[model samples]
Structure formats: structure tokens, C-alpha cells
Target: MRVPVLNPNYLLTSVLFVLFGSFDCSELDMDGEISLRLEHSLDMGKSWQDRGSLSFSKARSAIPTVNQGPLSDENLSTLENLCSKNMFYLIKVTGDGIGELQSYTPACTMLDSSLAEQITLFLDWRGNPVAANLASRIGVVGHKVTAGKFDTRVQIQSMENGPTPDTAAYIQKMEEEKSRKMSGEKPDNRSFFAKYWMYIVPLCFILLINSAGAPENGGR
Candidate 1:
């Protein structure tokens, strides 16, 4: 009786598939001592008026949905003043004993008496807010909130996708370029010597100098 021998290539591929599939992207500690607050500053961050509060817990899912409190009269008045001056509306997020402020002169908010109600908090994979204070963690960011008229609702959401490069298009482009080159495409029509004349000239000059300095008959 002969025992079936597993192909090494097949075994390696199976192992890799299992390892990659088992890899969980949500590795951050959701139970960390962190809190979020939606605040605004009319005086360019000189002060902050808290408009809403956000809290996270371990009992809930890894990512929690935050429903912001309605905007007050002061908030509306501040927005109006900033819109009149054509200045930016400043927003500050405080978490883990640190504060992060962002400023944007949104045209939507300026043109109409509108405010971006929905706020999404992009957190690092390690369950920390993707902030400058904590720069070591990896996360996906660049979220912008556009305003809706007579609305001031805010929500904080966790980062769904980690820092995964979407390089399929780039890889496809490279493969096409490679295939084109393999198909005898002469994108650079210049000869090798023509393309590398500077290097070749320097090398040839060095060889000539060496030959001139060398004694005749192999320095005998």
C-alpha cells in the first residue's frame, strides 16, 4: 500500500490561503478608554462649544453608531457669522486626552443656511482615532461631510476598511506595459549606446587614462 504524497506547491498554497483568510482586519481594542465630542470654535479654536457627545463600549459591536444631539441656537448663529465672514467653520474632536481640530470653508454651508449634520469619525485599526497624536497606527481616512439645509445631525463611525492598497489598476497597467514590451514595442527607439552615452563615455575615458598610465609590455 502506498501513502499518497502531497505536492509541496499545493500544500504551500493551501497553508497560505488558510492563513490569509483567517487574518482578521479588526485587530484594534474596542474597549479602550476613549471618548468623542463634537465641538465648534468661532474664534479660531480659542474656545470650543460642545454640540454633541459620543461614547464607545465593549459590549456593543466593534464599531458603534453615534447619534449626535441637535444643534442649538448658538451653533446656528456661529455658523451664520462664519459664513458671513467667508471664514472656515472649525470643528474639534477630543479623544484620549487629546484634541483634533479641522477647518473647512464649505460652499454648501455658506451658500445656504445649512450645516453638515452627519459626522463620521475615522478611527485607526487599533481602535484609536486616526489623529496626528497617534501617528503609528494604520487607517483609511479622508472623509468629508457636506451640509444639508436646516439639518444638524452628526454621527461617528469607525473605519471600515484598513490601509489596504488598491493597486489592482496599477498592477494591470504594469502588466499591460510588460506585455507590450514583450510584443516587440520599441517605445525607446534609441540604441543602447545612444541611451547610455554619458556612462559609456565616462567608462571609455577611464579605460583610456588607465591604458595611457600603464607601462608597455604589461609593465615588464
Candidate 2:
């Protein structure tokens, strides 16, 4: 068998380059500080630049906003600081007391060549909207993913903060919906077929099959 020709020094250099370039930083920020870090990248994620970090604790306490109301200018400004006036951002919720760190890096699409464009991070709570205005202002999308001891749930919503004069009206709307749902008001505007389309569609198919299987007879 013929032996393959190879350059030893070149291979060693290539290995060293890969080892150096593939390295990453996994260190978190400081302890006990729940915060959102805004970052962006050019050249298709070959490199990145951190804009800044906005503390959740600071923002929540700084604003007098309750569970329901429009997004305050103060709070908006707090989030705006994270972007450093940039239109696009990569949001990362850092700090302590947060359970299992998980991340989602979506594939770059034709609509969005850069993953950092319109990146949204949602911290879901019982009565509050999941940071809607912050997302809209900084160009981010939404989702809630939780890992339980024995279960997991994921909920995704639009980045829209709703109509003007009420940038966070959806919070109030959600509360109202929860009230309606708790009061036994089901959103059953769908027709019987629509409501049970899964069963109805398969059942219709079965009926059609049976009818087709039956011999066709015309009265003589």
C-alpha cells in the first residue's frame, strides 16, 4: 500500500490554531445580580461586542409599575441603556439565583442573517407580561421555557407590546383573560367541527372509506 504524504509542521500548526480559536468563555458575571446583558455581532457571529447589562432588580425597583399598566418611560430607558442606542441586540439574563442555564441559538435565515437582530429574552411571571416593551424597543422576539423537576413547558408569544398609550396593555388583557377563564368562560367561538377537527377529520375519512367500500346498487 502507498503511504499518504503529509506535512507534520503544518498539521501541528493547524491543530494549534483550532485549539486556540475554538476556545470559549463560560464565566458568568457577578453573583446575586439578576441582569440582562445586551450584545451584538457583525461578520456573522465570528466576533461579538457587549453593549451593557441592565439589572432586573434595579429596573423593577426603579419603576413604580405594578402588574398592569403602560410601559413606563423610565423602565424603557433602563432597557434602552442595555442596547447602547443600537437597534439590534443579543439579550442574556445573567446573575445568581437563576436555575439551570439554557440557551437557544436560532439558525440564521434569509429574513435575519444575523442572530443578534431582534433578539428577545422573556422572564415570565404569574400576572405580568413577559417584558414586551423592552423587546419591541430593542428588537427581540419571545418565549418562556421552564425546566421543572419532572416536567417542562414552553410558551411563545409575539414581540409586539400592543397599541400606543398602553405599551403593556397586554398584561391587563392577560389578567382579564385569566379572570374570564377562572370564571368558567371558555373561548369556544370555534364550531363543533373546528373544535373537534382532529376527531372529525379522521371520522369523515373513515365514513368515506366505508361508503366507498359498499357495493353501489341502483333500483331496477
Candidate 3:
């Protein structure tokens, strides 16, 4: 006996759903004492599952010594280990009456030597300076990390900026930064629509087909 094949349109729709569903995006709200959040998605870019938490604080520091740079043999060795082990690390320092300082390094192992060098330079140049500037302004530093294939970018924001126009503005800013870093485009309506065109187009096609058949199918 021969089995029947699934309809092509059905197969296509299923594939599309799976593809779009595999892209897992998650948010971790760091509440207290170092925490680790893991999310995994099998499809290229559709949905994700939380893999539970790992105690990241038990590992080595995420941020290297500023004075040592990336070329230091110690730092290089650390980087090699991090790369081989594929680690994600975060550090948080909180002081009374002073703003908190947080650092995140994700997918630290994928970084090439050159990129690692740049990262070290960036940290040495902007990390402390930015933290000190925020400290002077009576603001605490809140760090967030988004990991990528080759490199990771960190964002440091002020926690004591007072009530802004909106409570969720920080999330929006982080989303924009992540979108920009991933797409090389600013987070705007156009970019958002572009990113989701696959879904939009398919929905539009279904709508058009149904609308065209509606009048012919019934009097109502």
C-alpha cells in the first residue's frame, strides 16, 4: 500500500510555521545573587524553550583585568579556555549609596583573537570610564548582554535615572540595540515589518484568496 503525500500548501505552511516558530527570544530579569538563564531553540528562528538556570557566579569573572589587555598571556589563556568551554558569565558589584555595577560576557569562546583584542580595548576604554561617569552622576550601572556568533555587545544603563516617561523604556532601548546589532538597521517600523515579511506575506495571500472566493461562495 502507498501512503498519500501531504498537500504542498499544507507542507509549506507547516514549514513556515516551524521555521518562524523556532526563533526563540527570551528575557531574563536578574533579581538577586548571580543567576543564569538558558533558552534553546531547535528551528532556525522560531520558538524557544527555557533550559533552566545554571549558577554562573561560581565560575570565573566575565570581565578581564583592564590593565592586562587581550595580549597578556594570562588573558589569552583565559580566552582560549572560555572559547573551548563556551561559557557565559556575569559579574555584579553593589555598594551602599553607590550604583550597582554589572558585567556580562556571553558566548565568550567564539571571539577571534582580533575581536577579543578590540573587546579588551573597548572595555578598557569605555568600561571604567562609563561606569565612573555614571557613578559621578549618582546613577547605578545595569548591564545586559546579548550573545552572537562572532562577538557579543554589552549595554550599560543607569538604574537611578528616576521615573522616565515610561517604565519599560529600558527594555525598548535594549531591544533596539539588539535589533540594530543583528540586522545592521535601526529598530523602526520598516525594519520590523521587513523582519516579519514572511509571515505578513503569507497571511496576506490567504486573506486575498479567501476574499476573492467569498462573494462567489455565498450570498451573505
What RMSD does model 1 have?
A: 21.0
Candidates' C-alpha lDDT: 0.46, 0.32, 0.32
Between candidates 1 and 2, the one scoring higher on lDDT is 1
- Candidate 1 is scored at a TM of 0.41
Residues 1-220 of candidate 3 have per-residue lDDT tens digits of 9999875434544654553343222112222233333233222114443423322221124432222112234434554565567653333333333243333343242243233211211111111212211011112222221222112222222222111122134335546767797987744555645544554465556445423421211001
lDDT of 1: 0.46
**Model 1 ranges with Cα > 4 A deviation:** 1-34, 56-70, 97-113, 131-220
Q: Candidate 3: lDDT over CA atoms?
A: 0.32
TM-score of each: 0.41, 0.22, 0.21
lDDT of 1 by residue, 1-220 (tens): 9999995434533543443343343444555545677565666567777656556553235444454554556565666667677766556666654456343334224334334333444443345554311011112222222332223333333434323222344345446756888998866666655644543454445435423421221101
Clash pairs for candidate 3 = 20-46, 21-46, 21-47, 22-45, 22-46, 22-47, 23-45, 23-46, 23-47, 83-109
Residue pairs in clash, model 2: 118-139, 118-140, 119-140
Question: Tens digit of lDDT per residue, candidate 2, span 1-220?
Answer: 9999875434533543443333222112211334444333332234444434444332333322111122234433433443454333222333344432213222222113211222233432211223321122122332211110111112222222112222134235446755897999976465644543443354345435433421211100
The candidate with the higher lDDT, 1 or 3, is 1
Question: Number of clashes in model 3?
Answer: 10
Clashing pairs in 1: 117-153
Best candidate, TM-score: 1
* Cα TM-score of candidate 3: 0.21
